[model samples]
Target: MESVKAQSYDVHIDELAQAALNQHIAKNDYSKTFVLVDTNTKKYCLPAFEKKFEEPIDSIFEIEPGEENKNIQTCLQVWEQLSNFDGDRKSLLINLGGGVLTDLGGFVASTFKRGIDFINIPTTLLSMVDASIGGKTGVDLGSLKNQIGVINQPQMVLIFPEFLKTLDPRQIKSGYAEMLKHGLIKDKEYWDDLRRENIFEVASSIQKSIAIKNDVVMQDPTEKGLRKILNFGHTLGHAIESYCLENYDKKTLLHGEAIAIGMIMEGFLSHKLTGLSKLCLNEIKETFLQHFEKVDFDTNDMDAILKLLKYDKKNSHGNINFVLLQSIGVALTDIKVPENLFEEAFSYYKE
Candidate 1:
């Protein structure tokens, strides 16, 4: 397995990163090892992980899939399972799944006995480039995304493009949004390349995206400063995700799906508030819409989503701050956006 060393953790990218996992597990000498998975991952990914792991995991804990299930109740279930199985502080957890599983499992392990060793084997593209890095362990609180969690680094992260083969095209495209965000925030050449090339065909592109995030995270681990830039599009994206999940009439947007829309709306805001060029803004919208299907929203739904922004974790002094783009490859964080522009941003997305 090829490894990319990041500041917080080393990401081993290969055929499920088997060699790295074997080396780490052998070296650590933990009391026990537990593997966590979701239903989808269990059916599609676990066998591959098991084959690569070679050793016996003490127990396998499987949870239901989907954003809706990432909550306090699910955490309780995992905790109970760990307790019933005699898992202790010295036990190591191997989280083998997509973002939901990694986030939930990481949070569970971080809080289990005040922190146990854990490694992430991210199976989805979104997890590979974003969630599996950064050391942000979390679970959703009700309709909100990642509302309750901690900042704890995993022992290591294993990334393998082979797992992406299990995903449907939409799932794969959903992960592409984060990759696009990486390019837009840091490298214009990367952004242009993503626009011009087939992302699925390029392995280096994934590494480059992961590297960009790793660089930013290394500079600011606590999200106290530069790290906030990583929240680009996430503020509105999360609100939309929450609102859609809570509103039965509205279709539930996947994390990347909601964020794709958020990027478009935020792109319009970027053009208006941060001097981002119209050409760049148009390009962003065109590229994203080309990849994602349009989701329907009425004026009321938009208003509700906007209102939910005040509860955003990034807000301070009752003002909803946004991470806007100064240019295609440059981002400005902690910019306070006016209320009226919310509608205008929505209008731009509509057109």
Candidate 2:
């Protein structure tokens, strides 16, 4: 098993139903074992988990799958289930799904009975590399992203590459965006490698990305400092995502798609504000556009997205702070971004 010890827990990467989970289960004394799954994971991933884990699952909780269902109401339902099943502080909750399931399950476990032990088994590539490793857990509060979440660690995380096979093409592509972001913020060579056609040849790249994130989290787990680099494409990306999800005319954008556009916009802003080279900006734009379709944001869409950015969790005292790239691997954090730049960013994205 390839293990990366992160901020508060260890992430074990190996084939599912192997030795790691069985050994870990033997070591813990939990009152009950609960596996939490979404509608999709229950149908797809649960069987694999059951075959791998020899221990009996005392209970299973299923929630609706998707960003729309990630709300307080779903959390309330989970809480009620845990309560009805007599879950206690010692009880274990194993979250088996993608980012949505892991986020909701971790939040529920952290808040239920003043926090219980939970394990994350992220089924999607996005969750495996980003969501499962970070220990950042929360459901979206309406259109705002991660506005209500606790920075609580999971008991352990299990990542099996086999899960990626079951994912839709778009889901696979969504997770790839995060891996691309990791390279953008930390290693230029890593980014270049990701762009290569034969990039999948390096199976180690997935674990390497997880390691990169783990290194960042170990330094700043609470987003108080260096951890902000992880939000390189997330600031405006999240605002755009929230805007599209809430708006009547626009279709809801996948997290990666929104962030891919965010990266392009931020790359332009980096050139205009942080002195990131024009060459680098164009390269960023081209690379993202190759993988993600350009989002058509008109004047009104831009206005709505900018308004939603005001409620971003990264903002402090009404000032919108952005994490911009100074170079491929160098980042500038907490830059006070003017609202006018947002209009220009929309123009750049449109072009």
**By lDDT, who's the top model here?**
1
Off by over 4 Å in 1: none
Residues 1-351 of candidate 2 have per-residue lDDT tens digits of: 478888778888876326778887889988999999988999988898898998899999999998999999999999999999999889999999989889999999999989999989999888887897778899999888788889899988988888877887777778888888998899999899888844333345778889999999899877799999999989999999999988878988888888999999999889999989999999999988888887787878887888898899888899988999999988889988777888898899898
lDDT string, candidate 1, 282-328, tens digits: 99999999989888788998989988998887788898889999998
How many steric overlaps does candidate 1 have? 0
Candidate 2, superposed: residue stretches over 4 Å from native? 198-203
- Cα displacement (angstroms), candidate 1, residue 332, comes to 0.6
Give the Cα RMSD of candidate 1: 1.2
In model 2, state the lDDT of residue 256. 88
Q: Candidate 2 versus the native: TM-score?
A: 0.97
